[model samples]
Target: MGSLEEDELVRMVRDFIESESPSPTNSSSSNCLALSHRTQYLILQDVLTGETSSEAKVLKHVLKHMKGRRDTKRSTSLRNWLVKNLKIDGLRASLCQTSWSTSLGCPAGEYEFIEVINEGENGRTERLIVDIDFRSQFELARPTQYYREMIDSVPVIFVGNEDRLCKIISLLCTAAKQSLKQKGLHVPPWRTTSYMQSKWLSGSRKELENPRNDYTGSAEIGNWVPPMVKPRKMDLPSASSALSCQFSNMSLNCCNV
Candidate 1:
């Protein structure tokens, strides 16, 4: 599909929003207004880049309504359409492809898709593997291992559907976490690239507010106290005895002199 002009894309998205979800009397013109500013910007960016196709639109709509266990015929139809038509092995090259060193996939938004290729039998048979790679949200590795582990366990799923896409993402995360755990490395909640340490905040505040969940104790100095020492007491003669001894000594000294 040809890329759309900014204004035309906005109008089409607004129309789609109005048709899909109409707001109440007191609400805004459409439910799209309720989306985050970043999301709105991404929508515009995708549209302008010609990435906002019917499949993408349907996935976005389904994701927006995934709060509860709610299901609808429209969503089911979209999912069915994707499962029936989309081929997992040979997808559009623009979407995902493996290269000499790097494998480029979908845009790295909340998550990204990756295509891993493995050659077997002297490159006679090629294995086209698809896996989810958390981008800015989290980190993932060993795409080939994850694909092999997941392919036999889970049934074939059309990732064009938001629900299935999310499932695939979560599955990959779980596998990655398990792998890390097996290696005695704890997987953090947020990606390592994200800024968790800041100089502005105190050490204690930084640890507590860290999303990694690895921080448990405060980084602030503890209320430590030094060990106390008791003074040693020395016994002294009485004042009267000391006076008598001094007088005796004086008398002895005079006689000696």
Candidate 2:
């Protein structure tokens, strides 16, 4: 992620904390200090932006806040907020909508997102299950091997690990790219270059290809793919040419979830 992106993420964290946490001046002992909330926001910013090498600060922050709470309540709450507030919901919703890249258009492996809720000694724990059927979606020559065996073999990541969830998404997106590459197919040129006209280009293909961007902008600021606009007749050829140049120069850096 670029510096611009990191700042945007930090600002988002601030907004959430400010909105949810009680004001310190209210004098309610049960209410956490606003300063403490700010500190935690900074810690999360560092963790997400890779400014901090050690997650010890984050661990300490969680432990301190969750002292009497049972079974990692702070972690669970944070994880839930991330899942619900972030663009994860939007991405899942996209599955219900029609896309130009579906079946006849050389779609990637089909994925089903399932949520598992379980009762545990601690409380209720939730896990996200991603079932990708590469064979059917990509029309593979050997269906059973990868779909029935390999893709299913990848472990379902629990909801708490945002980083792990990102990896899982990146893997899925990579599979999509690979399928497109193998078939010698490409997404429409206009879809790829529309971001540039909106002054939203991040100068990296990683930003362009991030699946999170396929949803709303806040999902990933630097990588957010802008909503498309109708271009004028004269701008059509230039935009098309620019998209072609980008595709030709694109690197295999598909991990920006």
Top candidate by lDDT: 1
**When superposed on Cα atoms, how far off is each prediction in RMSD?**
24.5, 28.8
Model 2 regions lying over 4 Å from their true place = 1-114, 130-166, 188-257
- In the range 11-52, model 1's lDDT, one tens digit per residue, is 755553334311111222234435433334444333323322
User: What is the overall TM-score of model 1 with all chains considered together?
Assistant: 0.20
Q: What alpha-carbon RMSD in Å does predicted model 2 have with respect to the real structure? A: 28.8
Q: Model 2, 1-257: lDDT tens per residue?
A: 79997797567555533443222112111222232333333433333343122223323333342334333222322333333432332422111111132232333221222222223346744332221221233233433332233244332221222233332232323343344445566633222212111111111211111233222223232463689999876645678888887876664344442
Candidate 2 is scored at a TM of 0.21
Clashing pairs in 2: none
Model 2 clash tally, residue pairs? 0
